[model samples]
Structures are given as C-alpha cells and as structure tokens.
Target: MDKKEILDTLKAAQVYLSRLKSLDNELESAVKQIINTFEETERNIHDTFSNLKVVLVNILNKRENFLLEQAKKAKTDGLAPLEECRNVISSKVVGTNKLITQGNSIINGSAKDGLAAFSKNASLLGSLPEVPELKEVPFISFHVDPTSDNEVKDILSQLGEVSRIAPIQITELCEKPGAILVEWHSVENDDRLTDIQEFRLQRAFGDVIKEKHLLVNFNDCYRGLDTQFLVKDLKVDQPYSFRVCCKFEGIQEWSPWSLPQVASTSLRPFSWKISDDFLLSNENKIAKPTVDSPKVLYSDGPQFCVGHSVEFTFLEIDSSNAMLGLIDQILPTSSSLTSTPGNSFLVDKSGKIFVDGIEKCTRLSEFSKGLKVCFTCDLVNDHKVRVNVDCNEKRVTYDWSIDPDYKMFFVSQFYSPNWKILVE
Candidate 1:
C-alpha cells in the first residue's frame, strides 16, 4: 500500500478508536446512573410499604379494640332484664317458703291461731301478681366490609412515578450597583439532540430569601455563544437572589432550576452633567443617582462667581495627569491642566499637587480607593482656591487675583481609563 493511503487509514482508525472509547465511557456512566436511580426507587418503595404496614396495623388494632368494647357493652345491656327476672323469682320462692312454715304452725296451733294465720295467707295471696316467662336476649354481630382490603391494595399499587431532571447549579455570579450578572451551565452535561436554545433568569429581592418574592423573570435567547446574562434596573443597596434554567427552542420542557446566587448592590452615586465642550467617554460613568444626595455636575471651565463657591470631588484618580481645580479660561477639550492657559490646581497619581505647571506639594498621600478629594473655589474671598486631598488631613489653599474680563469655571481632565469625578 501507498504511504499516504496508510496514513489516511491510520487517522481513520484513530478516530474510530476515540469514538469507541467515548461510547464505552458513556455506556458505563449510563449504567451506573440507571442503577442508582433504580436503587433509590426501590428504597422509596420500601419505605412507603413499611409506613403503610404500620398505618394499617394501627387502624386494625383500633378497630378491634372498638369492636371488643362494643361487645362488652352489648353483654351488659342484654343481661339486665334476665338479672331482674332472677331476683324477682328468688324473692317469690322465699315468700312461699315462709307462708308454708306459717300454715304448718297454724295447723298445729289452737283455733284462734289458725284463723289468724289463714287471714294472713289470704291477704298475701291477694297481693301477689302472676310471674312472666324468661327468655335469653340475642347476641349482637359485627360485619366487616369485604372490599376494603382490596381498595387499600389498589391504592398502594397505584403509586405514581416521579419524572424530574437533576438540579442545575450556578457557577458564577457578579454584581455591580444597580446590576447583577449571572452565569450558569448544565450539571449533567447531557448531549441529547435537544440543544438548549434559551435561558430563564429569575430574581427575588429582599434581605432574606424566604421573605423575598420574585420580582423579575427574564428569558435570554441563547445562540450557544455565551452562558451569562446581566440583569439591570435593580435597586442599589438591596439584597437579591438569582436563579436560571435552560430551555430548548422547540421543546416545551426546561432543565431543572439552578441553585440560587445571592448578592447585594453597591452604593452608586447620582449621574452628573458634563459640559458640552468636554468629551466624556461612556466608560466609568455612574448611571443611577443616590436617592437623598444632591446632583453632581462637571464642566469644561470652572464655575466661579464673586460670591458663590463650587466644589469637585475626586471619586477615582488613576491617571498620572488627572487634574481637578478652578480654571480662568475655557481650556481646550483635549488639553490637560498643564497645557491649560489659566490658573489650575491638580493632583496626580504620585501624590503631587500642581498649580500653573509648578509642583506645590510633594509626596502627599494620594486618595485611597473610594475616598473623595474636594476642590473648592471660593471667589468671594479674593479668588481663593482650596485643594483638600481628603487623605492624611492634607490641605492646600491658593490666592489668585481674577481678571474681570476672564470667566472662570471648574475644570477636570484625566486620561486614565479608571478616572472618575463627582461634583458637589
């Protein structure tokens, strides 16, 4: 044979061998699973039968006791009349015997005594009534229903089979303020012909799972590309539990529900207004507003007035040239504080504070994550600009004389992707 033909045959043989191995593994797994299911079914049946036996025994014992009690009551009730008759007969016999003795005594006595005895006998005979005939009362009988045992047996035999799939489990759950992302996959890894075509996401909202009610049910159409779904529009600072299930496109059945994933939303600040001149990317922008807090604003130029003061807080500062301060000129949208043509105070990632292209503070502690650094421009007090690093109690104040012709506004510039701001 040719070498190419031999190589081709070898590859075909290898593919066939792999398929055979996979089939063998699948068959072994299926056999084990079936055996386990059969054993579980057998155990359940045995338990149910044992319980039934106990229940039936208790019922029969109760019935037997009840019947025995009824029989004793019947015997007592049936013998009452017979006992009264016996007592009456015994009293008559005693009276007759005494009368006979009195007669014999009178016969052997004198005439006066005989007359007295005869008078007493006549009175006693007139007072006596005729005796009634005695008969035995019939016994009461209890009859058992012939069909009851058969009915019970039928009920036991008609036990229904439970049809259910194995439970699925959630592999990962991620959460952000006002949003929750859920990811799950099937546990069985069943490779049936019915491919999963959709996922159902369910959510419950509350501090406790048992106390919570389902608030959302969403169906995500699956294209076999991703196993994750993101649920938005959730309330911040509230606890939520999520579960998901897989459904086939054409089939009506859905896989068993996945185990619930619990998470709570973080505190998200209010959305702020950005100036039209500055370009703001969609990334790192806060969407939802804090319920009780004031609105935040961002502008290309510093919003400075003679009597009014404006403050800006640095939510995040990742860039080396992230700037936040008052500017007297309308800085170019693309320029940083270093290139702006106005008085500007800025903080960098290296913990340095800068003003007008000059370093003012060196190695001051940088703001920690989630810490806010405030920049207040007080035009009322000789255009005094204050930079508070909100870390280590560091504060810097600058006095600048404003030109009457120039308009000043709050300015912020950050080139880093993680830079964020909130104006207060």
Candidate 2:
C-alpha cells in the first residue's frame, strides 16, 4: 500500500479506539447513576419510616402512661377497704388473745385474783369486733377498651406503605362554566386505571406557577380512583392550571405530578324568573310593569354559586325609569326590593350604580332602549363578589363584600306601565 493509504488506515483505527473508550466511560457513568439512585431511594424510605415510628411511639407512649395511671389507681382503691377490714379483725384477735390468756391463768390459779379479773372482762372478751361482714368481694379488674387492640393493629397496617413510581400524563382538560374537568392516563398506554388505588388532582392559579410541585400553592381538587375529575366553583374567565398524581392499591407514595394544563371557564347563562304578581308572558322572561310602585323581578334558577352572566334587553325604554341589579332575597311583605338595607345592588337609568340604596358611581354607562345590557358576576377569592356591567360597549366593574349566607339572584325594578324587557 502507498504511504497516504497507510496513514488513512491508521487514523481510522484511532477513531474506532476513541469510540470504544467513550462507550466504556458511558457504561461506567450509568452504573454510578444506578448506585446513586438506589442509595437515595433507600435513604428516603428509611427517613419516612423513622419519622412515622417517632410519631406512633409518641402516641402509644401517651396511651400507655394514661392506662398505667388508671390501673395503679384502681389497685389502690380496690385494696383500701379490704386493708381496713383486715386491720380491724387483727386488732380484735389480739384483744381476744389477751383475754383468753387471763382466763387461762384464772382457771389454773396461777395469779392472785386472776379469776376475779377474768370475770370482769368476760363480756368484753366474748364480744366480737363490729367488722362488717363481707357479702361478695369487690373485684376491680382493669378491662382495656375492647377495640384498642384492633385499633392499634389497624393503625399499624395502614401506617406506612411501599410504592413504585408510576409513569403518568394528563391527556386532556375540558372547560365548563365555573369548572374544569381533568383527565389523565398511564404513560404505559395500558388500561390500568382500575388497578390504581386513587388519583390526586390539584389546581393552582396560572400566575402562581413554580418549578417544583411542592413550591406552588396548589389546592387539592379531587382524590379518587377515577381517571377523570370535575373541579367546581372556580372563577369565570380566570386562568387556572391543573396537575395530577396517583397511587397504587398497596403503595403509599404518589406518582410524580403531571405537566400542568391551563384552562378557563366560559360564561354560564341562567334562566330568569319573575314573581307571579308581574307575570305577563313567556316563561317569566317577559313582564309588564305594575301601575303601582316598581317591584323587583328575581331569577329562579341555580343561585350564583359560581360565575354567571345575564343579559337584560329593554324592548321599550322610552320615558321609563327602571333599574337593573342583584338582590340576596325578597321579603314577602316588602314594599320594594331595595327596602332591605345593604341587601340590594342596583343601577339606574342615568348610568348610576347604587349599593343598598346608596349611589356609588354616576354615569357608569349610557342606558337606552333596544340596547343589550349584560351583567357578569363572579366570586373573588371566596370573600367578595365582583360584578361587571357591559352596556353599549361601556364596561364598569364593581366589587362588594359578599354575604356568606345569602343566595344571590338577578333582579330588575320597573314602575312605568307598558314598559317591556326581555331577560336572557
């Protein structure tokens, strides 16, 4: 072979040698990783069981101390009366023995005037001590609570569990009004949903994302064996993210959290209802204004348990003074819905908003006939109710301290005759 061909052949051999060395190093690294993983898992399991042992020992020790005290007290109390009776009987025997000795001396004539001394105490010697006769021995036996052993065994059986890591992934997230339905499946792609003991679904606000599952303030929404869960009472149009983990039947540890999925709820519409006093036509959606003072019309559907939206369209708003709002309830003898202080929130014809019959803001939006005015209401952090009103492209948002015991409803007040409105 020529010199150049020989050099090329040597270089090829060097490349193959380097590749072989690289493979050897990779193999060594993988072995080290396996050893490290095993050590870590062992340490974690040991620590978990150790902590559980400490807690259980503390609880058992407390119970043991309590029972020991009770047993000791029972023994002392049971022995008390018996000891007293024994002492009384022993004293009487000693006295009787003394008298018998004196009498024996007298009979044998061993002492001067012994007979006379014995005769003087004869009545006392023959009389028995006033010891109460025992009918039945009071047996104080300490019977441990019958279920205590079973309870301990049951606790021990459930104390700690062994589990293998499960490969899981969230498949889909479906949105509903004020809720989200989360679905997941095993990464193995097998039908093992039934084999799982339970699944834990958690949710967090989208803005509160974190790198680790423990870092985020995630709330547990559901825990069960089902592969799907529906989380309810969420805010409307608000961004939320969800993740899931699962455990096997015999396993105590949960699988790692799945990648978070984001979703938002759409506006849910509710059916409207007006009182029979103002009924005119069309399933309580249409009502004629009473000639007397204005009365409020309320909804009969599901209360504002979650976020909802309602639209009020004035079919005829010419020269009619009307108000649209929400009220917690209407009293039967009430002259007007706004009569109950702080229970009513309303907006008037001149684009003014009122809370509890007190005006909050003026000229919020231009109110006119044939225009659709939509009211959007939702809870804010479970403490306040937020309402957004959109009228002819003008939007206004208001928040109020929500009464926990109150069930909210949509309401409107009208006094002008021939005034018509369509509620949707």
Clashes of each: 7, 0
Each candidate's lDDT (Cα)?
0.58, 0.71
Q: For every candidate structure, what is the RMSD over all alpha carbons to the true structure, in angstroms?
A: 19.4, 17.7
lDDT of 1 by residue, 99-185 (tens): 777777777773445666666665765455444453446458888776997887787787544534443567876653346666777
Give TM per candidate. Answer: 0.38, 0.42
> Where does model 1 exceed 4 Å of error?
104-122, 126-139, 145-288, 291-424
Per residue, candidate 2 scores C-alpha lDDT tens digits across 1-424 of: 9999999999999999999999999999778756765786789879988998898899989988998898788788867877887888898788778889997777677866777666776777555545545555445555767698889788777865433433677898776544676788887654555578888988887643434453367888888778887676667787788888888677677866775667877745344565554655664566666565555666664355444556778777646567777777654655565465546678777778877777775456555668788877777766777778888888888777775445677777776665677766
Clashing residue pairs in candidate 2 (N, C-alpha, C atoms within 3 angstroms): none
Candidate 1 overall Cα lDDT vs. reference? 0.58
Q: Best candidate per TM-score, number? A: 2
Candidate 2 accuracy as lDDT:
0.71
